[model samples]
Target: MDFEKLIVWQRSKCLAVDVYRKFARCGDLGFKDQITRSALSVPSNIAEGMERYSDKEKVRFLWIAKASCGELRTQIIIAREIAYIAEPLAEKWITDTRELSKMLCGLINKISD
Candidate 1:
């Protein structure tokens, strides 16, 4: 299966790009770096997982991607609380992360079975 064809991968890639753009000028280097890395992990792991030769390896990477989604969501909440992100945009990102998590879960289950 092509990871690029997966909706979860596509959405995660977009989310990572959005995160990078959103924090392009952020003064908080630590927070920006952490969040962006977490965001990038989702899609990267998914691609790596799908390209693996075995189901076990694929599932492992998908799990990592799912974990990254959770990490990214936590960072989004923190960013909002710190006022580094505006309410509306933060809410949208939070929602996007949640949806991405769900999509990842679905893909994981499908692949696991």
Candidate 2:
């Protein structure tokens, strides 16, 4: 399956773009780079997994993508706690990340079977 056709991938791509745009004005290079890279990893890993030749390989990459979602969520929460991100946007990002994580679980389960 084409990863682009997957809702999880599409949502993750949107999340990454939103994150990148939101942090564009930030002065903290370290935090910005970390969060943005994690955000981008979600969709990149998804696409790479889908393109893999074997289901096992795909599942491995999907697991990595799933972990990246948690990593991104943690960074986002930290950003909010530091007052770098406002409440509303952080909430939205958290929501999206949670949903994507669930979606990834579902996909992994199906692919594993």
Candidate 3:
């Protein structure tokens, strides 16, 4: 299966891009880097998993992607609290990460079974 064809992967990729663009001018380099890396990991892990030959490997990567979703969500919440992100945008991203995590879980279960 092509990871690009997966809705979760596609949405995650878009989210990462949005995060990068949104934080491009951020003054706090450490926070920006951490958040962006987590955001990027979602789709990256998904793609890596889908490209793997074994189900075990695929499930492992999906789990990593799900973990990244959680990490990204936490960062988004912190960003909003710190005023680095706007309320509306932070909420949207948080919602997106939740959905992506759920999607990754579903994929992992399906692949495992």
> Ten consecutive residues with minimal summed lDDT in candidate 3?
100-109
Candidate 2 residue pairs in backbone clash: none
List residue ranges in candidate 1 displaced over 4 A.
Answer: none
How much RMSD separates candidate 3 from the native structure?
0.5
RMSD of each: 0.7, 0.5, 0.5
lDDT of 3 by residue, 1-113 (tens): 98889999999999999999999999999999999999999999999999999999999999999999999999999999999999999999999999998999899899988
Residue-level lDDT of model 2, residues 1-113, one tens digit each, is 88889999999999999999999988999999999999999999999999999999999999999999999999999999999999999999999999999999999999999
- Counting clashing residue pairs in each candidate, in order, gives 0, 0, 0
Best by lDDT: 2
Extract clashing residue pairs from model 1. Answer: none
lDDT (0 to 1) per candidate? 0.94, 0.97, 0.95
Off by over 4 Å in 2: none
TM-score for each model: 0.97, 0.99, 0.99
TM-score of 2: 0.99
Ranking by lDDT: 2, 3, 1
